[model samples]
Target chain A: METIAKQGARVQLQLNGRVREGFAEPRTQLCDFLRHELGATGVHVGCEHGVCGACTVQVDGKSVRSCLMLAVQAQDSRVDTVESLAEGELMSDLQLAFRRNHALQCGFCTAGILMSCAEFLGREPDPTESQVRDMLSGHLCRCTGYTGIVRAVLEVANERKSKNGEK
Target chain B: MKPASFDYVRPTRKAEVLELLSEYGQDARIIAGGQSLMAVLNMRMTQPKLLIDINRVEELHFIEERKNCLAVGAGVPQVELLSWPRISETVPLLALAMPWIGHFQTRNRGTVCGSVAHADPSAELPLCLKTLGGEVVLESRSGSRTVTAEAFFQGILTTDRRPDELLTEVRFPLCKPGTEYRFNEVAMRHGDFAIVSLAAVIGAGTIRLGIGGVADRPVTRDFEPGQDLSAALNETAWSLDAQDDVQATAAYRRQLVRDLGRRLIEEGH
Candidate 1:
């Protein structure tokens, strides 16, 4: 006899520094899980495939494509989205630089880009313009033409570098 | 787009996974990182009855230096090897090719064995494995066996493993010192799949050339330096019977391999 199909799987993970639990179908993507179940709509789901970097999130401190991962796979893992970077409506330094540099037009891709860049900047507090461009290569933004995004990431990197006393 | 419903099981042990595979046979698919499989499932290209997730199988996650080769477990993420200093020192070609696989986010979750198993014609890992002459370990409840990269990758999105088998690890042979290597591809965008990729390894008077994306499967040729490569390159590129796709045309792909092959060999890149 075949095993009975599971109706839903119980998934418990740390979201935005808080323990969260939900029941989802086995096929539910982490992106959908975060948005529909946890109400974390900031994790935009673009191009549902892995090409668009709009669903990027931090799983155990490493960046991963949320759309490509199942919600059940993230069980017991620490997950962070773009919203986690802000403090009570106070934008992150990267978000501030993005606004100052006019980095977003429609703002559809900003949240995911912010999350990806946040993870990148955490690892590389100081990055060259080319490196910044490389990091953005995975992302797709039709509006800004990538000029402002590159500028914003560089400005943030430079500021952090100066604060850390690194030339 | 959402994937079709499928039963999921996270087996913590290799024996459990093997038992599941044996029970489910062709109806089961092993999901490592789920980077490629998820996309395929979302597209409704495949609808397996069961998805055996091996991510929690700690026994399948490792990077070890065994006598003559580097052992990369099925659960080892692609990004992990990118930062591994020893992998860079041992298998320099793979280190140079990892960045071109995909974006950092995808690389962080995509596994080396997953890419090898998916066997996309244009993937960098398979081409690199072909150039490096790696081995793939396939296991099942019956027994286990190892197949060389050349024999393992039968065609596009195809492998030699049986329905009840799983690819456990990939062994990349350490390149001898002074082995110069170069990986170059021409993609429409920076992170897109290669239209035609060239993996060339030359040193100690041996020339190994492996090309991907322009064929149903990656093709390789070993020859001596200073030998005329045009005839062989053209022959191999044409022999593969490349087809016209949105990314590139059959004629264009054939020309690309011929041109890129000669340029890389001449520049010794």
Candidate 2:
């Protein structure tokens, strides 16, 4: 077999909600592709390695580090970014709770944390405070000391549970 | 840190992957989930001439329960295995330690076989494989071969896989009926690499222990059930060539191993 040099790899995937088609270098990180190629700057890139969790995105309904994936690797996957949480200038329920509770400061890590928590809340609508803390453990937030973030998530979870119970 | 320039290939078949590995030899690297490789590449630790992405190899993607062992393909993501009900019921040790790996994000892309191939001394999957006495399957243009976890991992970030071979599957022996298993590790944070981790399987008239992060590779030992093995475990801790690094001191790791071993045994672990 012969080795080929660097070349562009075509990437076609569902971004946010629409189909997106583009070409990226085979070595391009998924976060870079989403941020630069598709203009989804919501996916932050902190500690290009997988540690920081600042590049978390939803692939096929599961949270994953966009930085650890090649753009070409997401050939047919459905990706959800922090932008998906809002609807035409309307904030999501979780986002509203964050604002109500003062969950973010500086906001550098807010997008990734929100994305991760979005996936977690989908899976576990009714979680304990410890479970919420564990879900947030992978993410790092230097601001708000995580107190307000945890409280905000807990409030939303409780509100959802009560609303469902009422129905 | 961006990765150095390198060519990429996505082969849909395992045979093509092996052929590419053989052709590129040492200049080529197999990328399964890119969870570890991407980080290494970003740091420019290794700039291979080619990166053979194996995610498209359908033949290498599967999870099967055999007569004696459970086989996990190279393409199965770590999070997928973690959520699999069979893994929780059969190989509980793996399920327990999977969450201790990076976070949900990294686990979503990291592959089990990739972790086994990388052979990080502080990694959870390799430690679990060693504890369960798993087997790693490698294939090359010449032929295919399987190696035990003990022999497959030669050292930190090293394995017995030849440059021309591709790791296709890893088989973990099923836990015997009525066996009890426990996993414990201490890291700076929830998802950081462990300073020292211990895996214990007890019951069925046998007991086995595997320790990681204290040495170049995970070490395991088997003992008779109901025997007081604290002394033996302490001896084993001191006997290992544990290194002192920034994360921890060798003396601290030694004591941790001893204490954790004794605690696990005393708690009927």
Candidate 3:
């Protein structure tokens, strides 16, 4: 028999548009729950420690270290992972540019960089290269040298600005 | 990296929080944001019998501007504090140090109280709080009392915080106009822990300098206007006790401390 964390208070959480309800341990890490329980491997865990930024996810439109968050803390929160950035058939312009620039090599830190950039660009349409570097300074990408990575974000920022006319 | 299994409590009432802390005493570990504590627990460093989750206490999440100081709640996220313009405008040193606390992701999860409560010798907030002459409010079943920065930090990860008391809020005193403050840290990587960090607050009457990562706690030196800090560090007995660790040799850190002290005095003024 599984010991119950909450009996009557059913866990009601929204994960990328789908309603998820379950009785997970209050100490259950959201990163493990997303990948093992929900089968969404897009949110990869590199350091288990919260430094690598590989397991970042958006909780209420803010990027958070998923490894440090408990499942119960994420309850009732509007969670968005890399899986939510792309629709069924097509990916966002950021993703497309990341592919075009060969921004990722091992592809472990890509999901998080993509997620952070996607959200960051939404707030800052035309981010300078230094700004992108400042925001991306936390993420560790051993393979990509970040040459193409920074370029990919700049390309998307410029594209969005050109199309939207600097709004 | 699985943490030790432990009981948890989420107290909504302040009275309930104080009662639990008093009852549990050493067995209970209060978690504000769980950013640093969780990391330590994962590393098998600390295994408390119970975790008192204080993040849900809504009352401890405000940034109130007092008449003489700013009262920042312990449970307030660092990211939330960053968005508050008053915090940035009033205490520009903290605004400068806030960006280097960790990263955008970690900042979202880390709490100001948690960071200060942990009281790591290398952490950013502790140095800033110490330099700015901040005070922390401690609550227990009995009552509440405030501890000054100079007397608050006891040793490495140790504080005057009683076994039954919990840190609720931090008060950073207001500096007069034209107070030139500068904070700097030399970390291995951009987001990695600083090898040696320095925070200097210069005012019209005096100049206070804080150094972290070189000692077990934030070390401060007082220099009245027109005093030579370069000659002062060598004379201060406390500077002689700077310790070395795996990050950097003691000799190297001491050298940096002396050099940085001079540089901070020169540049900060």
> What is the C-alpha RMSD, rounded to one decimal, of candidate 2?
2.0
Local accuracy of candidate 2 as per-residue lDDT tens digits, A100-162 = 999998888889999988989988988899889888888888888889999999999888888
Model 1 C-alpha lDDT per residue in residues A41-135, reported as the tens digit of each score:
99998999888888889999988889999998888999999989998879888999999999999999999899889989989887888888888
Q: Could you report the DockQ of all the candidates, in the order they appear? A: 0.56, 0.58, 0.41
Total clashes for model 3:
0
Candidate ordering by lDDT (highest first): 1, 2, 3
After aligning candidate 1 to the native by TM-score, how far in Å is the CA of B171 from where it should be? 0.8
Q: At residue B102, give the lDDT of candidate 1.
A: 81
Clashing pairs in 1: none
Candidate 1 per-residue lDDT, tens place, B165-246, comes to 9999999999788888888888988778999989999888888889999778888888787777898778877887899999
Is 1 or 2 the stronger prediction by TM-score? 1
A1-167: candidate 3 lDDT, tens digit per residue: 11223222345678899998765565567787788777779999888778888988998888887888776667688888999988788998989999999999989999988878877888888788888998898788999899999999999988888887765
Ranked by DockQ from best down, the candidates are: 2, 1, 3
Point out the worst 10-residue segment of candidate 3 chain B by lDDT.
Answer: B234-243
Which stretches in model 1 have alpha-carbon errors above 4 Å? Answer: A1-5
Give me the displacement of residue B226 in model 2, in angstroms. Answer: 6.0
Residues B166-223 of candidate 3: C-alpha lDDT, one tens digit per residue: 8999988876688888888887777678777888888788778888887778878788
Q: Give, for candidate 2 chain B, the lowest lDDT window spanning 10 residues.
A: B260-269
lDDT of 2 at B238: 88
Question: How many clashes (backbone N, Cα, C below 3 Å) per candidate?
Answer: 0, 0, 0
